[model samples]
Target: MREAQFYNKIEDLIFCNLCPHGCKLSEGQNGTCRVRKVIDGKLYSLNYGKISAINLDPIEKKPLYHYKPGSLILSVGSVGCNFSCGFCQNFTISQTGETFFTTFISPEELISIALKYKEKGNIGIAFTYNEPSIFYEYIYDTITLLKDELDIILVSNGYVNQSPLKDIIKHVKAINFDLKAYNEDFYEKICHGSLEPVLKSIEIAYNYTHVEITTLIIPGLNDSEEEIDKLSLWISKLSPNIPLHLTRYFPNYKFQIEATPIETLVKLQRIAKKHLNFVYLGNVLLPSNTVCPNCNKTLIKRNGFEVQSFMTSNQCPFCSFEIEYIKI
Candidate 1:
């Protein structure tokens, strides 16, 4: 177990500042995330180096279309999450505690495993599947050990506090940030979190690395046209080049609402495209091809996770438009 970063001890209790929860815990008490705990008056990350899931997945599976298209990444994930979203897809692991089964893989061991897959086009490690920020110490240590030898990708909810967020952004090359909604009411009632910090995270992350935003379009929750408009506009204001993914949500975990309509995703895609240069529809058997924003020329054609065709490099051949993608 690693002593966690971004925490302080007050008397006999420890306050975790890793995320917005700011959970204060006495000895043997776990935080809202169910991973960090106060053990003997010190905060410890219970999930540190304890990997619950590991796989070599297509970069697109991270739903990251813009960064490193047509490449495979070594994806890794632990348990526990800061936010308690009602419709969590990975709830089985995210909501669980240290009792959940996990394999212990040190940072050096993980890097060695990644090196074995170099011929298979493994770019680097992706800290995903659960709220990675909760395992801040492990990730920070792993990235420090890597020293940019491999790419570091983060798929996160973006609910972390700025101080910790700023430190992690320096090591990551790209991120797929989940912007659940456009307003605070949806965040507080449905996600058990706030929206302002997420927006702040996106704004801060894009300045340091390539950032993409994903919003799971839940039915009757955050799928309204007005909400989509506000979200797209806010992202565009940051930079129209920021890729926005409008994913269809299925009933899962506590929220058993009906699956989001394909029509809703289609409509939201159009709404997002009006303001954003790169808008893609996910979780449906639809075209998620990336096109040149200027000339409408196809840059990358994807069929599910398979890349059927794509530009040889980051530049569009038809119009020579410089696409904002990591070409390796």
Candidate 2:
């Protein structure tokens, strides 16, 4: 087990400041994340190098529509998350503890696996599936070692504190930050967290890597037209060019609300488009295609996960408008 970072010893206990939770733990007890424990007066990361799942997946599966469009990326994730969102899609892994997990793979082994797939059009590694921030030890070490050859990516809730985030951003090439809502009350009530840190993380990431934002518009929770406008407006202030994906939230985990209505998804997309350049619907399909903001010409056409057609030389074939991204 690796020693966790951003912690302070408090007599026989320690306060872990990895994320906003600031979990205070007694000796032999764990933090809110359940992955950081205080043992012998120091905090340690229990899930380091203990990945629950690993696979080669499409970059689009990361829901990253703009960065390296159709390339494959080695997706990896360890258990444990800082938030207790009611709509967590991967709760079995994110909320489960060390007792239920058995996989033990080192950073070197993961890098080797990614390198093997590199020849087959894989861009690099994506820390995904669950919250990757809680497994900071393994991620930091692996990225440090593979920085020369790999482009590391983070799929996160954007709840991490600044110190650790600043330390790792140099290694990350891109990130997809989940922005659950634009209101603080929604975060506190449903997500068991605050909204400020997530916003700060997005701003920090925008300066460091290719940052894309996703807001799962849960029906009756955060899908109001006003909320969508607020969320998109905040992102637009950061950069209107940043792609904002309005994903359809399905009923999952503890949230038994009805599936997000397709009409709601389309309406949110329309509302978001008012502030952002590239807005798309995920989970359910809309006209899943990329169009030029300047000319209204189709640039790339996608049906579900399939890329059906590409026009121009990565530009709008009709208007010669340079495409913002390259099809990989």
Candidate 3:
């Protein structure tokens, strides 16, 4: 196990400042993440370099449409998540630790695995599947070692604290932040987290890396039109060009509410598109390809991960309007 960072010890207690939880633990206690444990009065990351899942997936699967369009990325995740969201899609891996099987791979070995996929269009490695921040020491070392050779991206819940997040964004190329809701009540009740820090995290991430937002629309939880309006408007203040994905939520983990109706997704997409230049639907069958914000031309077409890029450059082919996207 690796000794974690962004922490402090005071009067026999270890304070974990990695995320908003700010968990203070004694010997043998674990933080809210269940992966960071207080071993002999020192906080240690138990998930460091212990990979639970790995796959070569399309960049769009990270839901990152703007960065390296049509390219592939090596995605990996460790066990443990900071939040206890009832509707967590990857709860099995995200919610557990030692109970599940994991393979221990060194940083150099992991990089070797990533390079093997480069011939098949793998762009870079993504810290995903579970909360990447939970295995803070591992990802920090891996990304630091694998710097600049490939694009480093993160698919996160935006629940992390400022200091560590700033450090991570320095090397990260792009990130898809999962914004659960707009109101504090929903955050507290549904995600066991607060809204302010997530908003702050997004603002911080924007200054560094390419940012995109995703909100899983649960039936009665966070699907309100007022909330969507406020959410989209808040994102627009950062930049309307930032893509917003409205994903359809189904029964998962603990929440057994009926699946999100397609009609609701369509309606909310209209509301969000009003304040945002790019809006797309996820988890259901529909075209979520990149379209020109100025001329309404399809700049990138995606059919279940097989992407066809139409824009040779960052400018729209039809209107010649400047757009923001990274290509290889």
Candidate 4:
């Protein structure tokens, strides 16, 4: 295990400052995340370098609609999460402890694996699968060592504390932040977190690196038109070109609610289009294509995670209208 960063020792207890939860623990006790433990007044991350799953996935599968679309990325994840979302898709790893699905890899080996895929057109490493925020020490070190060679992408729930987040954003090339909802009540009751911190993370991340936001639209929860409108407005204020992905929610883990309807996703996409120039629907079998904001022409065509780019730059290939995507 690796020593944690952004922590303070309160005599007999160690306070974990990695996230807003800031779990304080006595010796032999674990934090709210159930991964960090205090031993002799020192805190250590039990999940460090303890990978539970790893795979090669499409950059689009990160739900990153803009950055180097159509390319594959090396996705790596460890066990444990900081939040308690009821609808967590990867609950087997995120909710349960690290005892299950035993797998291990060192930071150097992970970097080696990522480097080997450069010829296959992989952009870089994705700290995903589970909450990489909690594994701050490992990710920080790995990305620091690999920064000169590869792009670093983080697919996170966006519940991290600001101080550590600020320290790591420079090495991160892009992020797909999961904005569960716009309402604080939803975050408090459903995700065991707050909306304000996630919003702050997004705001801070946008200025530092490529930022994209995703909201899993669950029916009867955060699927209101007002919520979507507010979310789009906030993102638009940052940059109208900021890509917002409105993903259809699927019932998983603790939440027994049905999957989001196709009609609802279509309707919200229309609402988001009013504020944001680029909005895409996810987890549904729609025509995954990019359209021009000026002439309404199809710019990029996508099937599943496969993307066919029509525009070379962030501008529309047809009418020369500007698109907000990054070109590799």
**What residue runs in model 4 are displaced by over 4 Å at the alpha carbon?**
none
**Taking the tens digit of each residue's C-alpha lDDT, what string does model 4 give over 1-328?**
8777888986687878888987878889888777888876788888888888888899999888778878899998888888988889888888855655656678799899999999998778999978889878889889777756988999998888888999999889899999999999999999898899999999999989999889999999999999999999999999988889999888788888989999999999999989998898998888878778789998878998778888788787789876655554
Q: Per-residue lDDT for 1-328 in model 2, tens only? A: 8998899986776888889998878889988888898878889999988888888898888888877777789998888888888889998888876634657888898889889998898889999988989989888889878966978989999999999999998679899999989999999998889999999999998888888888888888898999899899999998877888888888888999999999988888889999988898888867778778889876667877776446536677787777654443
lDDT of 4 at 301: 83
lDDT of 3 at 157: 91
Task: Please report, as a residue range, the 10-residue window in candidate 4 with the lowest summed lDDT.
Answer: 96-105
Which runs of model 1 end up more than 4 angstroms from their true locations?
A: 325-328
Candidate 3's TM-score reads 0.98
List the candidates ranked by TM-score, beginning with the highest. Answer: 3, 1, 4, 2
In candidate 4, which residue pairs clash? Answer: 314-323
Model 3 misplaced stretches (Cα beyond 4 Å)? 325-328
Candidates' lDDT values, in order? 0.89, 0.85, 0.89, 0.87
lDDT tens readout by residue for model 3, 1-328: 9898989999999999999999999999989998999998889998888888899998899898888788889999989998989999999988886734999988889899999889998988999999887877888898888968888889999999999999888898999999999999989987888999999999999999899899999998899999999999999999989989999998999999999999999999999999988899999899888888888888888898888988788888899998864443
User: Candidate 1's C-alpha lDDT?
Assistant: 0.89
Q: How accurate is candidate 2 locally (lDDT)?
A: 0.85
* Model 1 lDDT tens row, 215-239: 9999888999999999999999989
Clashes of each: 0, 0, 0, 1
